[model samples]
Target: MNRYQSNPLSLFGMVLWLLSPGIARADGHQVSDPMSLARDLVHRMTFDQKFILLHGDLGVDFHTSKKPSGAIGSSGYVPGIPSLGIPALQETDAGMGVTNPLNGRPGDGAVGLPSTLATSATWNIELSYAGSDMVAREARSKGFNVLLAPSVNLAREPRAGRNFEAYGEDPLLTGTMAGYAISAIQSNGLIATLKHVAYNFQETDRNFYNVMIAEAAGRESDLLAFEIAMGLGKPAVVMCGYNRVGTVWSCQNHDLLTRFLRQELKFDGWVMSDWGAVKAPSDANSGLDQEAGAQLDKSVMFGDGLKSAVRAGVVSQQRLDTMNENIVATMARQGMLEKHSSSGQPAIDIKGDTTIARNVEDEAIVLLKNDGNILPLSAQKRLKILVVGGRADFGVLEGGGSSSITPYGAGIRIKADGEGEMGRRYVDYLPGSPLLELRKALPNAEITYTDGRYPSMAATLAHQADVVLIFATQWMVESFDAPDLSLPEGQDQLISAVGAANRNVVVVLETGGAVKMPWLHDVRGVMEAWYPGSGGGAAISDVISGQVNPSGRLPVSFPRREADAPRTTIPGFDKADGAMFDIPLIEGADVGYKWYYKHHSNCLYPFGYGLSYTIFSYSNMNVTHQHDVTVTFRVRNNGRADGKEVSQVYGLFPANDGKREIRLLGWVKSGLRRGEEKNLSVTIDRRLLANYDTKLGRWVIPEENVMLVIGRYAGEAEIQFPLHLQRAEFSSLDMVKPH
Candidate 1:
């Protein structure tokens, strides 16, 4: 018989091969390729088995767990196929520690790191790494292998409810910080996910709004931030947003996924849809690999319908195989498939984690204004102190949303009778309190407290105290945009009244993002504590009592007025009650400080602006160019105490270049003793000098010469150096280090 001819014995062998899901390659060969391994597994999987991997597993212990809906405790679980030897995947929410999975504190308790905005304000990249590592450890301790964290989304719109979850307004700063966090999380053996892919700036119409942004504009701003993160972090997964990009949902956008992310940016990771985000079976071919949280609510985005679609050739086998390969390949590369089967929770050090959280909070406390130097309250003077408003004794305010972290102690429950969905939730108040900590630090002094319910009463009380600490807060949640930037609930009026009553007034703002400070000039000292974490209380005491020097800088500009921002009126949907409308990103590259630079507008506090207990001066600027360019300067701590300073370097391309403006080229943080000086250098990535040339399909050098400016903040450069630009075109931000 011919070798190609099939007999009874040959037919039996072929059937056996097909039945064995663990068999080798189709050609009876083994290849050492990750993709090949994934493909081999896909070929053996049945349509039903393949469909199961496309959605979450109904294994979350929600009924027994205390976590609220949409919280980490309610996060979905996915079971693996035992026959295929794939272990179950346990996922959790956020970089701010493993969010209270039970919705409330469970056992010995977990740590809550400072909000992402607070961490970013430090302008210290190493802190990002440290914070991520600690959080990842907590995730492992909770028996989770995936961290849905390190949101690289830009704070493009100040009112963006999730602004606290993002890094900052600028792409360079946001990308650099997120990259470190992503790398650190993965380094701890957990998968890190970069989220809310494109133009997810507003929460008002998040689920149905369409972002009609120009492709080129998108690439340079928010997309640029994601690109930097993807190149540096190489995260295992990319979570698409709930809204549409242009006309299609981000989860089902072919251009965004297959064309941009997969082709131009070279992201090889699998794509996962945001909870209840996938809307059609055709989305299977458009880059959505998994539909998350589907089993929780029994949503039927992908199940029997997907299997039928595949069988009928609506979604080709090639597309189905591609999805399976992406998922399996990512799991294999991350070693998730190998070690996920292990049992027992990893070790967690509560005290150690608290220390990390405190350190970040201490460094992130921005001293926006210190008019009379009334801050660093002298321990030698025995004086009366008054702490007003914001439930300082209760807990620090945390941003509301999925990123909200439940601390280690008693969880605060809200009354649901008169509250909205975002308002009626638990607030975890751990071991620290600003009021208690402040009282402990000033034992000899008489400390008084007030709710500040009556402005006149509070103002009268403030006048009697030797010093006043007014704690003002504003809440920002994910489902809606802030009504305005001003301090809500008459806090601004209270602050203004108190400032008028006492010249020694100090305002401690516990907020999610920048707030309009009408009392900025009247107060003696101002602190922007952007949602400091569980240990925020102790950190605040340290800064006020002179135990720690203030080093945090403003990551986003505090525009003098809301109108000073890029867009005064963010366009409304203008559609029917449930219909979708489009909003374009017309700002282009002129975002944040760039907009201020072009408009020459006066901001209340520019990006990178901050004041320390000690003063620093910079001089001796020098520049050198080779394959890369470097700027060196001497930073001297010209004061009586040691402190840290973040030196910012900016670049301005020639007008002849396609885009002409000042950009944050590089930055570095330095700590020095009083009167000590250090020669520090900041390197400018050659990629920073170029813009994405869509037509050329590469980053092109735009100018022959670039001007370098060094200073403590943007628009306030102390020195300038001109440097020559070379290497016209290239790709890959892996070679670039902006910090």
Candidate 2:
């Protein structure tokens, strides 16, 4: 059980040991410690060499500026000082895969995992790590060191464009998932980036708007997710967001970068600005270690302007040295400074990586509604199945933006209508044709497909089948927030038309986030497939064909209507270009399910809500609280089918001076045979039970009764246990854990 010791029997142990920093080797040398190594390297560097480490070119340099000679044309690049044995920080956008933007590296492609939200939905930390490691292996093969990924930002705003790229709304789930991902990347000797360090809620005018929330609220919610991720992963880099946290830009914000991230969260890595995030040269003095994509910024402050500031004594030499040290330490911590061998390294396992992606997607496909359990598509019955719409006959839809891959089969691409790179965003689909997979799943069944371009024609085609599946999609990406929650491009009308003709209509949603379902009652089944990556087609077919039981829970709630959300309209949607807008989060930490619970509003589907082909029932529940609250419950697979079930535990913390924490304490996913019963125990994450106290400057767990529930979803408290807890306070979150 020693954290420092590797357990051959435990894959988790191996992961920790592989990723844990300062672990000494047999030669009495710390495997990857940057402190001593970075200090020595910095002392030997010339002023010109120091500046080389400070900034670099965009790997996908579309600008007129000369691209850095060392750039690999990935995402960001910084030249290495060969004299100091520093490796060039070759960066890549790794939200899902090793991106070759615009096919910059001709004929280059890598396997893409399911959307991050999909991975988070699985609630399987082990799988999260494995998927990330798969991608990391491919990244290292392509000679990239830094991976900008495992985004931990809460999916509080469902309409937020990049929600598909991040984890989920809950701090506990998102953080834990990201932690494992970060661990996996770093373990593979790549610098994993835990990014967008603060509240980067929406993409509308991201560079001009500010996310206004109280410090305490920010800590308990968004910042809390980052805190847990950092504690578990110790990621090599923390990318500053493009938005403003309060009055100052996140990169230049003293409290965000220095106080909260560096001091409070105890992040050892340096802070790098998002591509062109720095506003001024003085922003460097506020804790930005490096400004990547210098050309993207208006002033190129981290470049020529930074040099001027250094000469004018506006920025100290000591500060510059510290910045250099932080960057080198991260690289050194991963042994990037040392000469390594590829002789022993394994080749890229594309097939193996694809399997990992499919496994995650299989678990991530949440069955929202399955009336009469009309799933597992009875192979014994010679049935006619019709699959229509969303071009599933060709490929499965993936969210657009930098995270997208050209995919293995590389079938189709529908370019978006706009101006620059964001304008060039396309409604891309990965190479996983669901129609083909479904046909393969049920060879005996007669299946046909239509594009669903016309409502009446698709409806007519629906009448000829035993079951009709409408593949609905809502494409979202960076630089644009979804106008609303409804499915776009007349898909809803198509579904309605098809549903009117077929009673057994199933709407398979391949959306970026939640979408309004007006035809909910009309459809027999609903599946939230999310933006399934390269392996999506097979993963979707796996669940519908009952090859794998659906276990994915809603990471974010689906509101009945867009009005039910905290923000009815995106903050800066209608504002003028240069005018700064504010996203005042008065709801604060009461986000996601908490906000709905607080307002007593009803959502179409609640967080942690999912269905299986089989049924599960809970009993024999017991709760106890000492230093931490522990719950033990019995779960039985009541139905005839063998299946996996995700038991979510929700807790309503006692009110503390009118504030309380309604959060997910923990969850366990288990596979049980038909009629089998098993007991499960969860040691509540004490951090979720506590509230961040601004005045006291600490986390405070109040003395009050906690309303606990072992439920299938957040909306239900089917099994309840009310327990009282004494007041507890921790000056540091690290002190709250059991030693």
| Per-candidate clashes, comma-separated | 3, 0
For model 1, how does the per-residue alpha-carbon lDDT over 115-162 read when each residue is reduced to its tens digit? 899999988777777888888888877777778888877877877778
The candidate 2 region of ten consecutive residues with least summed lDDT is: 1-10
In TM-score terms, candidate 1 sits at 0.90
Model 2 clash pairs are: none
For residue 195, what is the lDDT in candidate 1? Answer: 91
Kindly give the stretch of ten consecutive residues in candidate 1 with the minimal lDDT sum.
1-10
Q: In lDDT terms, which candidate is top? A: 2
Per-residue lDDT, model 2, residue 348, is 77
- Return the lDDT, model 1, position 179: 74
| Whole-structure CA lDDT of model 1 | 0.76
Candidate 1 ranges beyond 4 A from true positions: 1-33, 57-73, 101-109, 295-298, 339-346, 415-420, 423-431, 573-576, 654-660, 733-739
What digit string (tens of lDDT, one per residue) describes model 2 on residues 186-239? 777888888897888788898898888988889888988887777677777889
How well does candidate 2 match the true structure in TM-score terms?
0.95
